[model samples]
Target: METISIRAPSTPSSATKARRSARTRLPAAIALLPTALVVLVVYIGCMLWTVRLSFTSSTLLPKLDWFGLTQYMRLFANDRFVTSAENIVIFGVLFISGCLIIGFLMAVFIDQNVRGEGLFRTVFLYPYSMSFVVTGVAWQWFLNPGLGLQKLVRDMGFESFTFDWLVNQRMAIYTIVIAGLWHGSGLTMAIMLAGLRGVDKDLWKAAKVDGIPTWRVYTSVVLPLLRPMVVTATVLLATGVVKLYDLVVAMTLGGPGIATEVPAKFVMDHLFERNNIGLGTAAATIMLITVVIVLAPWVYARYVRPQGRHA
Candidate 1:
């Protein structure tokens, strides 16, 4: 005898699952709608508004009239702005490198499972918890020639112990770099320490079995594995470098004759103190562009490239 075979329908189950999933997700979608609207209206809207103002002839107020690239031309021609750009470049290089080097060393030290590990971690990370304003103020006092290190050294019978970089026109920016390193390295150390802890014990044992030097193992094998942490620290430090205002304000006020002036300070001075809104917005726009340029590559590699591969 021949038997007829039949398959149960699948469409109704698939339709039911789709409807159930939609019902489950509807509340979450509704919850996120307001936040999405605020981001669009507040953050993106303000960015567009700022960019628009950069192309105007506004001074002491915002004007909607078109003014071409006149503000940019004036900005580039200004000697103070030129110096500010140079100072920021110098500060950015020294500050980022110094923090990374010092932070890595500190992380290595803490990774040895030293006694009082918690206490050391707390001490190392404590500076990062303080605001930049406080760090700047404290360092300024400590670095002040007459009131801080110079005075103490001089009082101790070394009258020629000149450590007055804080007030010297040529060396003033390095003082800001020093303060930045102190405030930022702690955070980097914490990041690197976490990365170090995640390293496999088997790798260390393998290196030991191979008679490899500890330093060689770290530089050759371990450093590459910590690239993500290094990138994270770099991004955080770079953002700090870009928005560097309150620190300079508290520490130098952009003086020893504008020697320590940064792009952020330049924008503030033009927008508020100097009342050149057009030029200020142009400076701000340049900064925004710079940040976008720096981040685009990382974003593409991190998010976009992975998705492309999956696709």
Candidate 2:
């Protein structure tokens, strides 16, 4: 046989391409280093410290003296904490569901290409521009029995009109829900509207050709396709619900005998107002654990599963 020497094709281009890509990304990575460091030091570090302190008997100030689950025991046993947990559940469910429903409807209505679309879009989104503190205060005034809706209605010659939910222990939490919905629905609407706008017009045309009713098309076709948007909205709303402090403070101040108290407020009271750092840290840790428990599965399903499949 004739002597033949055939070398494999060179992959220098691939190597060179990777090198160039790395070189290009170097600047962006460098730029992000400061932010990454800050997040690690401030957020993660503080979280770890808080968790550690939760195991201690710190009061008035942080101390490393271990105390096991004493604080947690007291936390669960406390009526105020129990009420706060319950109130948070109610607020979260109603606030999230209300925002989703109202936001989706608003988005659908806007998608109809009605006249003054800009005006309507702005009107819907304007509330989200205001700070939560402002929204809470404004809604508080509006919900006040003596000065707000009840007063206005009563002044209109209706002696029987009474809308004192803001001060009613049984209904105070629902008032928080109303304010939460108003403050949050606008953002959800904007997000859903963006998703709606991005959808292919061909889908609508096909649905129309099939003689599908609008509501059925939405429920079956359009809404399903907006799952990503829905997920995004849900996450945002859930975060708002979890870290719900400012709104409650500004609106109800956990009034009506702690009817509207929430976990965050509980933590705040323990940490600052009550000078129980141990309890505060324990409450914070509990909230953290609760969030992780609730979100871990969804997060794994949404992100980890896909990446795992690729791996």
What TM-score would each prediction reach against the true structure?
0.90, 0.90
Q: Candidate 1 has what TM-score?
A: 0.90
- Model 1 Cα lDDT, one tens digit per residue, 1-311: 00111112223468787677667556766777687688888988988998999999999989999999998899899888899889888988899999999999999999989999999989988988989899989989999998999999999999999999999999999999999998999999999999999999999999999999999988999999999999899989998999999999999999989798999999998899988899999999988887898789989999789979998
Q: Where in model 2 is the C-alpha error above 4 Å?
A: 1-32
Clashes of each: 0, 0
Top candidate (lDDT): 2
lDDT of each: 0.89, 0.91
TM-score of candidate 2 against the unseen true structure = 0.90
* The 10-residue segment with the lowest total lDDT in model 1: 1-10
